[model samples]
Target: MELRHLRHFVAVAEEGHITRAAERLGMQQPPLSQRIKAIEDELNVQLFRRKPRGVELTEAGRVFLDRARATLAHYDGAFEATRSAARGEQGRLCIGVLPTTLFHPFVPLIIRAFRTTYPQVSVTLDECMRAEAIDGLRNQQLDIAFLRSAIDEEVDLNAYPLLNEPMVAALPSDHALARSGRDAQSLSLKDLADEQFILYARKLGPSFYEATMAACIRAGFTPRLGQEAPRITSALSLVAVGLGVSLVPACMQNMTMNGVVYRRLKGAVQPKAVLMIGLRRGDTSPVVRNYVSLVRKTAKTFRPSEKEAR
Candidate 1:
């Protein structure tokens, strides 16, 4: 009926002697024998037969012994699992990540390090848009999210600014800037003033969309917006084919599409894309707490290496 009863039953069954079973259980012989009798009465079946020197298990006792042992084992496992969860070593962590931020070095570094540190925690990644990431955090569907900006409207949503990576220009392989030896070193935003630009819709990621437009405007020209795509990666693909050029997060340079070359921007003030982690204000789950802590530590050490993506 109870875990202690199952344990007592198993110890008695295994030892096959009342005195020995009590010694194994660190209890008295009389109390152990009475506990075994109580189990049979509670089950409404004869589980043991008295013998001259010891007790013999009846057929019913053998069956009950198996069940009792199995029950005790399961109880032990459940107890340990509960402790593990309390320790933040076991649980599910659902993360909603913006598509644009998903491939960044900061994002993956946190995920890999968290996975290594809490191997028992289940980490689920949902690659999503900025809006979806916000919604997931607000609705409690996601434990945390990685994105370009923090949604300040929701009082319950807490944002931690991770790192800022400079936006670089994605140029076509045969484009003038890519081909020019001097411009090849670094290109200014003003250099792309006359070229057509591919812009992904703001709804896909408003932070990226705004950063691109703002950089171009400050450079002294309203960029000729020629093509529009649903996503930044799609816009980059368009740029690869000479349709247009686009500004993207520096970390995105790792995509390595054919005909696409990434160049640093040169200026006193350059556009910077930010990566932020958003979470609910009062989430107290150990798994979530561990992830947030790991994220902060990782962001501190995140350095963009050419091979960090690999």
Candidate 2:
């Protein structure tokens, strides 16, 4: 009727003698015999053929032995699964990232490391806008989000700064500046004042839009705003086609977008882009804690000359 009874039947059936079975189970022989008798009475069938020296399974006992063993195995596995879930060793992590965030090496590198450490945890990665990523965390739809650090101002979420790199100019390969003799040297932000700027749309990232615009203003002239894209990487595509010049994160230079070139920008402080991890406030899940700890460790070793800007 219960798991203990199944285990008792299996022990007696396997040992072939009630006295020896009780010894193996750390119980007395008399109580073991009574339990066996109770099972037979409850089922209205004889489960063993008793002999002077030992006992042997009846036809029905052989079938019941197989079922009892299977039942114990299933219960043991389910019990372990519950413990694993409580320990955070098994479950799911739903992660969100902005399209441009993954371009930074740290994003994928940390994710790979986490997967290696917690192979039992399932991870789901999604690319989302800043608003969507924030909303996902608030609604319990996301466990973590990699996004621009500008969102650190958000009161409802906790954002950890990961990387900070100066902004640079993205020009069409055929543009005069991309081909000029000064290409090897950094240029003042004022140099691109006359060119139409391919801007990241303001609605998707208001802080990014405003910071870029403010940097241009400090350069002595407001940039001529042209085509707008949802993200800096998408803006690069427009720059490649001569739609307009763009100011983007220095790390973006690693993107192998054909016809696009990155040049260092001088005197543009506010245009710098910073990456951060955003999580819901008061999240105590160990899996999320483990990921944040990894992010902190990885962020510490990032050097400006390596895996980031030049």
- Cα-lDDT of candidate 1: 0.84
**Candidate 2 off by > 4 Å:** 51-54, 150-155, 180-194, 210-224, 265-271, 284-286, 302-307
What's the C-alpha lDDT at position 225 in model 1?
86
Clash count of each predicted structure:
0, 0
Per-residue lDDT for 190-277 in model 2, tens only? 8887899888899887756777899988878888889789887789889988899988777787788999988887663546787889
Error of 1 at 112 (Å): 3.6
Residue-wise C-alpha lDDT for candidate 1, range 146-183, written one tens digit per residue? 87876787898999898888888889998878987665
Per-model TM-score on C-alpha atoms: 0.83, 0.83
